[model samples]
Target: MHDPIWQAEKKKILTRLSIAIYKMTDEQLISLLHLFKDLNLKDNDKLLEMPHSHADGVVAARDRQLLIARFFLLINQLSEADLLKFMNRYEQKRFSMLREYPRVPCNITLDLAADGRAINCSAMDISAGGMFVESCESFTMNQPVSICFSLAEDQLALKIKGRVIRLEQGGIGIQYESLTKYQIEIMKNMIDRLQRQASSQYRIG
Candidate 1:
């Protein structure tokens, strides 16, 4: 019941499935991806009664291999139209709008507690999640860093704790960590209003 080989084989099957889907025409590709999705969602429904193993404890490994190869060949031609429809439906539901927020050049100071390094950087963008500060130096990934940045004036300045989630050529990605209830409330209201305006514009377009 606790066989590692079976797990490896299953992984191989899924990998093959992904490769196959990427190779199909748009319509055929959509159908193949849908099959996997259905398998995940309707496993208990017994849609396709495919035999997994023989009575003699022998797996039909050869047949499964051929089927995997064929699936890959068919998936090579999936249509872009079908791909866009699927993506739009999924992404739009998850994110209310796909608009990028307007970013103005602003100077911000960052103090990293790990090294006691103080650096001045320009902000690339700002959203409720966090802001991207343009810097050439890379910070430790997943490192907790203290950031004290002023916006507009000292009245709207933010002193927040954040974690560095990613590092890239331009700058590091930060996710905000520390904030008082009042700060969070203010940010949420601002973000909701901005997103609503963006969503309205998206609909008009």
Candidate 2:
């Protein structure tokens, strides 16, 4: 049994680490999560295989590697249950911070594929991180969904995967799966254009 005072301190540290992880860039966070998923706490050699960051400078990359190494070392000290608890806390922190991304209204029709079936839905709004689709179709929470849509007049279609995160009275919120750099850039450009258009319309009214 852990001492009461020690347990409190452990919880505090885990919370702080979770918050810090939440503040990392999406790519970094994704990499960290992947590493954790495949990690074997008993295998110290895995720590040496940490991926090097593509950060600009050598110093930056080295610093990031060191940080990740320390994080792994700390995890090695945790019991399986403690590690699970930490992961849960990290996920909670991540979802709570996702709404910080800017969202804009959109009206793009898209197809949602799940469980060997496809449902037609329209995007109500979108952000870099996720989108909300207006659909009467029922979807389970955390259900994996494949989304395919094209922007107006755009010949290229965007195919992305996401998970159902929230179910509203009339719609469902989808958080995108790990996006590639190109996908991230495309979403940012689209959001910028929509925001500018919205601003123009507001001024005209």
Candidate 3:
């Protein structure tokens, strides 16, 4: 089902983006063009302001990262709301390690087993390497555990072993020890579905 509210929000976001790009100074425009090359933005030939081009060349089909960089380069022209939005996004991206797989924020109920005991807990977020599980129970770093859960609308079952790598206030971070090929595929699919859901919610919100 197509969401009308999300469509409207997307339209508003594009409108704001167009207005913001239009107000960029020539110097800022040049800076963005260089940043585009630095980011290796895809289909970059489409970015050139050809002799007959009428638009600013920051069109819809451009890479999301490229668009984000342009926003940061032209932060002075954006409204307070838009500036804060892009700044926060950029700040978060900066903290992420370039070599690490980005974590997908989600809440998946699963059983966390440790030392022959299993407790139901919520998997707060997941990445290619591991997941952060929220529970009232305490866990020590390097504790071995197994996570069992269903995926693909509960059509398939999954169980994998991991080790607690970090202990936090309310939860523990578990890193996958030895993942099979099948486990990797299902995890990728789960992350893909989660990211799509998050994108829709972010647009509407």
Candidate 4:
């Protein structure tokens, strides 16, 4: 029952899926894993009864197996560090206080626009939710600001709108507003790279 055409089509689907998965944020990937688990737990009769193009039970079962296999294969390809980071983030989301996401230490210079002027600032640390900017300029709480910065790794430019949530001696905490999925994905990737670099340096020392 080996069909070359079906195998070719499956390969194409998996290739596209891999690209999409790579671009997904950690939360999206975790959600997809949950979905795959639910699908795997479903009975064959239930799967066959579901709305799908395949009318034959055998084809439906084969498709389910292929789907699960492809997803796990991609998951398996992730490095041990990457997998550990994902799980750590998952646990942080469930139990961490104050901050909902983990922050990665960085020293990226950026432009901050507020009060009709652009001031140069440097980010001390960044998380998916926000960042702390080190600047001498005074910013009042809840003041709106626009930030533009490029990640060092890929030079990916990001312009984000945020508000000053906390004022400190030399810096202000900024909480990002209405972040798009794409922006979150880029931020997550940058954080992952920074974290991995930090870990390597720590071990070296």
Candidate 5:
């Protein structure tokens, strides 16, 4: 087991990432949970290619049930892109954002233009490709909607026109309009830097 201080720091970091982080879909969140569990099971700090043998049975026994429930809960709360971004960040812990840029979570206020209906929401996760936003308002699945938000540092304000791909309690899933080449470049750079830093630190420590 890691030392008390180390464990505390790890939990603290995870908690901070949870709150400040963007959204994640149910499928993505389950994958992340599995990743965390797998990382923890590594004895020498090297990530395992598969789950440990000892726990393999347990993992397989209830995999379907666990996935269905977990996925439902995540859909109720997180967004797809946010989910992907956080999973990437968690997988690349303790890296410099400059060398490894963390996915920037967007906090957006969505407005329904038809009647000026609006709600305050934020991403559960984000990537240059797309993002997931948690909403209090529910919409029919595959319904088209208008979205607006800024990228990191509020530098780039984007008004995207997209559709709701999935729907659940408290929110609906959206796939944003396609991103520009520049945005994709920025996201990839950030992810690469963070991943390298995480791997290096894990090796040294």
Candidate 6:
């Protein structure tokens, strides 16, 4: 067990990364999920990668789900070039991208675009054009979805319409549609903020 304060304290820094972050199609997320689950990862501070032997049932089982969110949030913030380098290690399988705007790590909820069915989901990353959301709910490719999430520095929640461009076992890729002028501005500003933060950290580090 860890302190909750750690999550809140590290939220800002953890969310921004100096890399190319792209949305993943559901097909790709499923594969990535499987790939990561079996990884013999060293115990890193930002992520929880418990060894399978020490992983008892129940608690570890629950954390694995959380791990999916945590791990992918980290993954989504990696530069596309970096991600490709990492994925290329899996020579047998190639990870594909549906490409548009780069993604910034974000946590948000998803709603049905047509009927506003609310689903609790975390965003792996986001962009003015679209985002990648992780959820186990049953949804088909091309389904319409509405995203409701807040920028790290802003309290105001953002709602935008998107289409499910792709699907994977653990998440879905959404492509923005009919974005308003205001929404576009919000995304641009947020992206700028993340970029600025990442650059600042680079200089400091």
Q: Per-candidate TM vs. native?
A: 0.40, 0.64, 0.51, 0.53, 0.36, 0.45
The list of candidate 2 runs beyond 4 A from truth reads 5-26, 30-73, 76-100
Which is superior by TM-score, 1 or 3?
3
On TM-score, the candidate that comes out on top is 2
lDDT of 6 by residue, 24-68 (tens): 332333445455444434444445344232222222334445645
The C-alpha RMSD of each candidate to the native structure, in angstroms, is: 15.6, 8.1, 17.0, 16.6, 15.6, 18.5
The candidate, 4 or 5, that scores higher on TM-score is 4
Please give the lDDT score for candidate 1: 0.51
Off by over 4 Å in 1: 1-114, 154-156, 188-205
- Tens digits of per-residue lDDT, candidate 2, 157-188, equal 89988888899988999988756667777888
In terms of lDDT, which candidate is stronger, 1 or 5? 1
Candidate 5 lDDT by residue in tens digits, 37-92: 54343242323223321222223325434544543344233334444454565656
**Candidate 3 Cα misplacement greater than 4 A, ranges:** 1-100
Model 6 residue 86 CA deviation in Å = 37
Instruction: Indicate the residue-level lDDT of 138 in model 4.
Output: 82
Off by over 4 Å in 4: 1-100, 153-156
Model 5 regions more than 4 Å off: 1-116, 186-205
Q: Candidate 1: lDDT of 167? A: 84
The digit string of per-residue lDDT tens for model 4 on 36-89 reads 343333333332232232322122435444544556564444444444454455
State candidate 4's TM-score. 0.53
lDDT pick, better of 3 and 6: 3
Per-residue C-alpha lDDT of model 3 across residues 39-95, encoded as one tens digit per residue: 443444555322221244233323433544545445434444544465455345434
Give the Cα lDDT of each candidate: 0.51, 0.73, 0.65, 0.67, 0.49, 0.58
Evaluated with lDDT, which candidate comes out highest?
Answer: 2
